[model samples]
Target: MTQATMTQTKVDNGVNVQALIGAREALEATPAAAQFKWRATCQWVNGTHSRSTVNSFFGLGEEQERPRSFTVDADHPEVFAAEDNAPTPAEIALTGLASCLMGGVASVAQHRGIQLYSVRATVEGDMDLQGILGIDDEVRNGFGTIRVTFNVDADASQEEIRALVAQAQKRSAVFDCMTNPTNVVVDVA
Candidate 1:
């Protein structure tokens, strides 16, 4: 849904003082908040140990040196959940839009040499079941349109920011794709 209707995804809302204290006690075993990284181990399709052609990885959170391991292929470019179940490619498309915007905006800022601190983006798109479910042949299917509401948290003037966005549009290929469709040639390989 768009921001007009976007609400927070539900997370644990429970609050228990004793539980909190116990959790704090458990955390006390650690050095401090500013001194940790998390890691995760991931295993992808096929195998590992130099015999696997699998394209998966692992990572750790801030407390660890790396993330959990997972597999990747044409199916998942961002890998998967450390638990072996991350988001699919489509979820990543949205990420692509945001990332494209971020890169574009940042490039514009940097090319212009603006000392901006942070850039944030809110991306939204809608898809009908017919498109993804392959029920309707008439529907365009994949994201009729994706709207990006950029909330650039930088100390720049509105005029400069607007100019930056304009520059970003001038440079962002994905933005061009959405604004301008890319022609394709179909062939059976």
Candidate 2:
């Protein structure tokens, strides 16, 4: 059977029963060793256009893995004097944030035995390009503020869902990464 068909068949009460069970088992077995490192490579195409490729899932104990290769393109809008071929980097960052939050929501809901009907997250970031353009030295080139709204339909009380969302935010790696400062070293090759 196809993957979609299998998924549909394995779903129970709006949750993927088999997948959740498997994930729980994996987590239980791995526990403290369940850490993972994700890597992506991006190459500049030309004039505010670039492509990124994601393929591998690396972890502490997994010795053999299949390559799941996919590519995404990023480009600036026409107003920026570039072709609007794909979403800008800032847009992609928001996408990543939304996706990570959604994943957290789903996982937490499943663990709490809450059946999710639908979950959606809207993420917005405010930024000023003056810093990037060297027009304003005091302006930062990154997002000045970001807001996220999550709309979830589930078989659970509003208070429960709110608590779940708070827990998810506390546990979400992307959320922590965005909010907390990290040490980054840049080396020119």
Candidate 3:
């Protein structure tokens, strides 16, 4: 489904949130690990209340202010990685993976009429010095991909349970690396 379709729906009680996320998981998962990439727009302010916008959730709830914290890249549209104590880009990526796998499995379980009592995912990544410092060309940068260890509680044989999880991941838009491959269109906004 298109990204617009995903955002068109709103949640008054927040129950429809999962359906919303699942609907646009494909497109939403395309952008970097920004909190929200519905083309978030923020104006600069030297004083308090730095950025404000009508789009997305920014400039709305909480009456918050943009702290001095921010990161800018010469390429791609500028992103608000965090205000002050914002989670690092790497950290956000890990969270996305967890959400994708766990949510995907849950959705599938619903279809199979299986009661998943507990589901947990732990993810880890390694950043080589060269990748971190942007010094080594031979060594690929970023997460070099990631690994996930899923601990699940269910009533199925090991093979059956594993197959179900794998199937869910396949349908998951966020988990499909090749399907929702990220495109870094950078040029600073």
Candidate 4:
């Protein structure tokens, strides 16, 4: 096959593998270009309800803006003595984790030339409210455990699917952030 034909055949699972490879090569060539800064602003709407907006970020050595602004509302449930405005912060964290892992799975599958028919992820997090309520100092303010189960239909063996998920976990930034300690600074201006 010609070089062009070989390159054209690299597309899989709706991802252009050649482009992915090209991006990696470009980042490797300029290591500083790989640095990215994500930003989000949150505004309090009412009791335990707030909206966070994501419209721009710093990436690839320059400032970048999204094609459209996006906002997410977070609030406590009715049981927490607040309006059920939207998903809770913990739920949003779960969503981020699931999305990050799923994206990794798709990217890995595409690069590996695996044809994916469907992918579904179920994420569950167990947390105790005692810590947040100051009822139990021993309990953590975050999830005690988080579990992710993926149901993927692809043209690959069971072992390959497991390997794909394992690789996704290994490469997932959200997984690393949640599993490891990150320095966070909070101050009122």
What's the residue-level lDDT of 113 in candidate 3? 45
How would you order the candidates by TM-score, starting with the best? 4, 2, 3, 1
TM-score of every model versus the real structure = 0.53, 0.82, 0.55, 0.92
Count clashing residue pairs per candidate.
Answer: 37, 0, 5, 0
Reference-based TM-score, model 2: 0.82
For residues 1-189, write the lDDT of model 1, one tens digit per residue. 212123432222132335545655766765354244223233354321111122233322242322444433324322331322334445566776778878778666654545456667888888765865578888766787678887775546767777888887787767776777678666765
Q: Is candidate 1 or candidate 4 better by TM-score?
A: 4
lDDT for model 4: 0.90
Q: Considering summed lDDT, which 10 consecutive residues are worst modelled in model 3?
A: 72-81
Winner on TM-score between 1 and 3 is 3
> Cα deviation of 177 in candidate 2 (Å)?
1.0
Q: Which predicted model would earn the best lDDT?
A: 4
Score candidate 3 by TM-score against the native.
0.55
Worst 10 residues of 4 by lDDT: 1-10
What is the overall TM-score of model 4 with all chains considered together?
Answer: 0.92
Candidate 2 residue pairs in clash (backbone atoms < 3 Å):
none
* Candidate 2 residue runs with Cα over 4 Å from true position: 1-32, 62-64
**lDDT by residue for model 2 over 1-189, one digit each (tens)?**
223233443323455656867876987897864777677789999999999988777675564355677899999999999999899998998888888878878777766667678888889999999998999999999999999998888777788789879888888888888899978778889
